[model samples]
Target chain A: MTIFTNFFYSFMASLFFALLFNAPKRSLPVTAAIAGIGYVVFILITQNLGSKPLGFFLATLIMGLLCEIAARVLKMTTTTFVTIAVIPLVPGLGIYRTMQFIVQNNYEAAVQIGIPTLLAAGTIALAIAISTFAVKLFLHFWQQ
Target chain B: MLNEQEINKIIKIVKLEAQIILENGGETYRVEDTVMRICRSFGLIDVEPVVIPTGMFITISHDNLATHTIIKRVRRRTVNLSKIDAANLISRQLTTGRISLDEAIIQLEQIIGDKSKPKILTATASALSAGFFTLLFNGSLFDFFIAALCGAVIQLFSFLLQGEDMSNFIISLTGGIFTAVIAITATQIFNMGNMDLIISGAIMPLLPGLAMTNAIRDTIQGDLVSGVARGTEAIIVAIAIAVGVGVVLKTLILMGGGLN
Candidate 1:
């Protein structure tokens, strides 16, 4: 139940974000659905595995792979799908909370929240890079 | 069978295509690849393109006769994936010999001249995105409304200021201030809504997630210069938003306004 609701909210949010970014009209729903599923997987991993970085990494890996496949099928630029679909996992809340803790003069709590935020962001980036490389390698081998 | 004048013409057209891609949030490597593909299709085999976050340089040599290079500076960048898609399509068609040079030029111009969606649609998008994000953050229905209002106002504020000569840092700073002020005030006056949830949800759209992703992608592709530049951009925008929201929140704290 909770997972479904999370998916619903994230799906709606990413759909509107795709609109805000002016993605091609035909690919809007597809990218938004990818984002929603990616975020839900992130939540599930975090809840069960108790590892936030792993969650971020896996979620972005899935999103990036989906976006690449979608780009091939739709014949659009891969960045179009990758950029919009990754927004929901951006750690906006972590950044905000870190700022809030700093403003409240709690450096200890600020650092606690800040380091994880940076780590999570780095993990997400690495996952995207890996996915792109994986796809390129697959194509290279398949073509030969 | 290509004359110097025709080579020059192809150079200009290819330059314009690359410029449009870079200026409209396309990746640096994508710009380079597109330039190479387009130039190759036009019979300019010896083509080299160097693209960074801020500019692009393309050099082409024709049969050992002469080398021509064009350096284009790209100052303003905003997210509009439709333009990137259109440009991508044009380059694909050109490479496949499905379109003439003249037709490609016409299509590229139409894409460059095309306007984004209406302001109202963008604003409504911001509203709904922020509103739904609030729910994702466990905010109540009331908080969703508050965050939606903050998101709309901030979107409009930035939209109005986008055409000005102001820097992006200033705009993001002002947006942060606006988000904090509005969320805090709405929560205080109405005596409802979670301030933390509203603030976080409202700032979601302003984060530099795309920049960070692009930075990593560029780095992995060995475009280290562009990767570092985009990484800096992402860090700066993140800091600006944090400082803006922090300053406002700190001021309220000093005034003894409990952030309940």
Candidate 2:
């Protein structure tokens, strides 16, 4: 599929997820748009880094930040929007990769990928946390 | 026409209106102002509004029956006052010194307890089920079938376990593990991917990633208590699936089991 098509799918998927959580109607469009942007960014980073772990790291961080901004702009709970946005970023391939390693009895490779996957998930979480803190701080200072 | 008792009743009605709005995820400031306006409309000019952060509460007072009638009229047409409408109406009586705070609390508890049970359960199940199906399909047809099944099962299980008083965490964990095992087995056995990616996609509704993402987002958003609680619950569910799969695979290896 074309990049545009892919982004559309990503956006719709995220929107559906957001709706599941009963996200405010106003927030859905913004969340979907940001999530699409996150997917595109991930694709570009992956292509450039050529499967390096750092590439995935950067992509997740970017996605997290984008999601946070979308949540703030929509004035909805971050839990609903961010969760939906991150759906596309899930390492489905990583799980498959880990399964292949385990099946092959390559314990070393499995462990390596497993730890990195865990870290990758953590990096995404950290990015969201940092961005939220920054936004809150900015709001506090701006109000004063 | 407005007696003290009626004035208090109107005030209570407004407070309940504010509480319902906030609980449905409105901002704190908005709810406070809404409550204050309702009081003002009821002619409680000297009403000192105390803004409490953690607990959602509103109080209104009216001087007489006419004021209560007016407040009732305003409340009936108000949007998004489902849960706290009754409480707010009662609180107005309290504020006019018609009823004691203890009475107001008892009434609030009874109204909230009775009204909230069905709505909360239904919403929670629907949300979780919808979330599950969306993940299962990765935006494909398989999501629809699997989501429906998972949603039904989760709803039924939740309903049954409501009597047992199990938490959402336990329900989600058990549901996740069951879904994961079924998905893995279906993928290996049926080769459903060849026909529109059905089997693997069906399992998508059970993914733990959605919960993890939500947990992280909540934590980042400063709802640390709920975030940590949800995060831990999600992690545990993930680990349960991993362990369950690991054990099954180990058993199969020992038994010389092969994919049929």
Candidate 3:
């Protein structure tokens, strides 16, 4: 129930952003649904794998793949759609934590949280990029 | 033989064709010259064209003449407006709601207009910036309703103050700083969640981080020129955002003032 609720909220938030960006009217509802499902799946996997560094990397990779597939199916711009949909998965909390540490003058803890936050964001982007390239390659071959 | 520019002209001409047909109340023959004029304007000088015949048949009756006359007027109006210049003029007049559709169509036929691209890209960028800020501060629900209303007002302000050539880096920086101040104030006044989270999350849309990542990826993939340009732009935007926010925050702290 908790997971379901979280997914619902995330979907609503993402969908709201998608519409605000003037995303295609037809795709907004589907994008929001998939994003919610993606969040739930991510939470489940992360919990099972524990908070290990490797687990984090793998989870982000899978999330990126899922987002790419959704993007292709929707036939829309990947950057705009994927970026907005993946908001729920972003470590926004981590960024906040880092800022808090900085305000308290805890330079060490701030660095610790900030570095991981940056890495997480990069990993998400990397996964999306790789998946996007793969999708393009597949389309080329299919066309030929 | 149609060049790229001519092909674009034809597309614009075809879009106008629909409006002409509709205004003629479904008469096909009277609007034929408009189509030919459009083709000529596009420099399709030596062309063999086929006309697909269409007509409206009516029984011989007293009421039919009035209908036929109305249809004739519509068809004549269609032919007159079919030229590219007439079409362009009519399109603009219609868009601005300055003239009736019938009059615009008549004006369209007499002119072969040149195509002019608009210089609104800079205005588009500024509007996007303001939209991003509104999204961050208001969230999805409220932002959607409010941003659109605010966007038009802000657009005029941006146009007058900065013009279309205003730098994206400067715009993003100012937006980010404004967003941070608002977020911090809201958090304090509402006793919201950690100020850090609210502030950071709110400004995520304005971050140059995503742009940097994309730029690096493109560079690594051998798109050197695009990568370098995007990377440089991202770095500049990021520096501007950080400096703008940092200065404001530092000022507040130095003055022994807090958001609360």
Candidate 4:
């Protein structure tokens, strides 16, 4: 649907997950907002650029950087907010579909869907790691 | 810089912090870095912390001599990010001049355990998250409601099992079975068309997203042991979920349940 609608659902999903994990209650709104932005970025990039992997990569990078800033601002670890913020972009449907294909004895379809889905997950992780390292280094040199 | 007694206290504090971080699902390297930083900030000259998914070992030394090594067996590790956040904050303050050693110790102790909100609160949170995730996947409102209620019940079941010795695999296997059972029943009753959306949405709460993500991050940081361990853990959890769902579905098909 609309970008706003997509972002709204993303925000809600993140907000509740933040709650489930006992994230600092006060930081829930911030995490939800960031997740919305992250999801929106993913949708825009994937929809416009026609590249799911690139969308996840760029979205994760932006989300990771934002989480670092939010952590420093909130004086909490990045994991607190990042976990919820990153959840929306997780390929949950992909994983589920792959399992469905496998159980249906459709190994070919399982591999077809599973490879790209796993690749997307990998790209997201790599992007997050790269951004996390970058932010750590930035804070490192900036502090000194 | 700390004297002998203070060094002992520092060791106690940092070890506790490291154990909690690992249990709270911090990245393996992050746990090592935090433990090392705490020891260094407390004037320990040499520090080595090794963290796996299931346990941690930390050695503190001074003057190239071993002072103490603490081994902590982490049980029931789960993702509770707020604990990690609090520990990280306390350690940062400990390193800085903001909180004294004693105060830091107290704070770390306070943050050591996993924080549990009221069961109703968490159940509602699970419901809402699962509902919104269903909507995000373009499921209808009816499917969202079904998934939300199922998600909440599943989460409550898991919460109940927290005190038990149930393995993650068993918990997720049950989760997958319950999810499929619920989705199948709900779709038949409600005349919903999208089984895929409902099942996927319900399963979102069970996916090993954090474990998988942490596995990759751990490997990226060169903590190969932790990385492989977490990766294996994630795979097993995923397989458990798949098996749980697939078995139930196949049995239903055999029984002529007529799942749409």
Listed per model in order, the count of residue pairs whose N, CA or C atoms clash below 3 Å is: 0, 28, 3, 0
Best by lDDT: 1
Point to the candidate with the largest TM-score.
1
lDDT of 4 by residue, B5-85 (tens): 887888888887887788878887888888888777766767888888888888887873446888888886877777887
> lDDT tens digits, residues A16-90, model 4?
988888888868999999999999999999999999888999999999999889988887877787777888888
Candidate 1 local lDDT, B1-260, one digit each (tens): 78887787688778878878998898899999998888888777898899998998889998856899999988888888889988898889988989887788888888888775689999999988988888899889999999899889888888877756556777788879999999999988998889999999999988888899999999999999999999999999999999999999999999998765
In model 3, the clashing pairs are B80-B109, B85-B113, B86-B108
Candidate 1's residue-wise lDDT over A10-68, tens digit each? 99999998888888999998999999999999999999999988899999999999999
Q: How large a fraction of the reference contact set does each model reproduce?
A: 0.90, 0.11, 0.12, 0.72
lDDT of candidate 3 over A1-144, digit per residue (tens):
478665776666566555434444566676666667766666676688765344445554555566667656653334444555665566645655565556556799989988887777666656656766677788899999
Off by over 4 Å in 2: A51-73, A92-106, A140-144, B1-173, B184-231, B244-260
DockQ, each predicted model = 0.85, 0.14, 0.11, 0.72
- Compose the digit string of candidate 3's lDDT tens values, residues B1-260: 44444344344444355344433222222234344444454344433322222222211112112211111111221111113223434554454567654555445443424222122532343334334333333345334323333333333433344423344555556654665565556545755434443444444444554455556556556656546665676667655655655555666677786633
Candidate 4 Cα misplacement greater than 4 A, ranges: A137-144, B64-66, B113-115, B257-260
- The lDDT, on a scale of 0 to 1, for candidate 4 is 0.83
Native-referenced Cα lDDT, model 3 = 0.49
Candidate 3 at residue A135, lDDT?
71
Worst 10 contiguous positions by lDDT, candidate 2 chain A: A91-100
